[model samples]
Target: MPLIDKIAWLHLHDGRILSTRSRGKDAYYLPGGKREPGETDADTLLREIREELTVTLDPASLQLRGVFTAPAHGHAPDVLVQMTLYAATYTGQLQPAAEIEEIVWLSYRHRPQVSAVDQLIFDWLRELGELAE
Candidate 1:
C-alpha cells in the first residue's frame, strides 16, 4: 500500500486542539504536513508547522503521541495514509498560511467536521480525557 507519511502537532489548551481547514476544503485537519526527502520527523514537523501555521515547535519537547494508519481521505479503497503525530509546546501566535485558509480551535464536539484520521485522533484524545466534549 502506498503510504502518505505526515505529521500533526497536537496543541491542547483549555480543552481544545489546534485545527485548520484548507481553502475550499470542508474537512478540518491538524496543522502539519508531509515529510520532505532526507528530513527527520522533527525537522519535517517544524518545517510544516512553520510553513502552514507560522509557528515554531520546540524540538526537544516533541512527544510522539501515536501512529495512525487509515484509508486515504477521499481516495480509493486500498490506498492508505500513515500519519505520525507529535505533540509539543510551541512558541508563537498561529496564523493560517500556505494552503490553510482557516484556523480553528476544536473541541471533541466538533469532531464530525474533521477527516477520518483526525476523527480517530479526537476519539483517542477523548478516551484519554484530553479533549472536551
Candidate 2:
C-alpha cells in the first residue's frame, strides 16, 4: 500500500469548523495540504494555509491534535493517508486559492457532505465538545 502524508488545520469558531472544497472535487475537507521535501509539519501547514486559504498561520500557536490514518480521500483503495492535525490561529481573510473552490463553515450536521476521514474527524471533534452536535 502507498502511504500519503498530509496535514490538516483544526480551525474552530463557535460551533463550527472551517472546511474547504477543491475546485473540481466532490467532497469537502479541512484546509491543509501535503508536505514539501525538507519541510517540517509547522512549515508545511503555514505554507499550505497561506496558499490555499490566503492566511498566515502562527507557528508558535500550533498544537498537535492527533495523527489519523485512513483510506486516502478520492484515491484508490490501496492508498492510505496519514494526516497530522494541528490547531492554530491565523491572520488575514480567508479566500479560496489555488485549486480551492470555496471555503465553508461546517457544523456537525454537514458531515455527510465531507470526505470519510473528515466525517471521522467531525465525529471526534463533536465528542470532544469542540464542535456542536
TM-scores of the models, in the order given: 0.96, 0.96
Task: State which candidate has the highest lDDT.
Answer: 2
Distance from true position, residue 12, model 2, in Å? 0.4
lDDT of 2 by residue, 94-129 (tens): 999999999999999999898877888998999999
Across 23-95, the per-residue lDDT of candidate 1 in tens digits comes to: 9887998888888889999999999999999989999999999998888777788888788999998889899
Report the Cα lDDT for candidate 1. 0.90
Pull out the clashing pairs in model 1: none
With candidate 1 superimposed using the best TM-score fit, by how many Å does residue 115's alpha carbon deviate from the native? 0.7
Best by TM-score: 2
Candidate 2 lDDT: 0.91
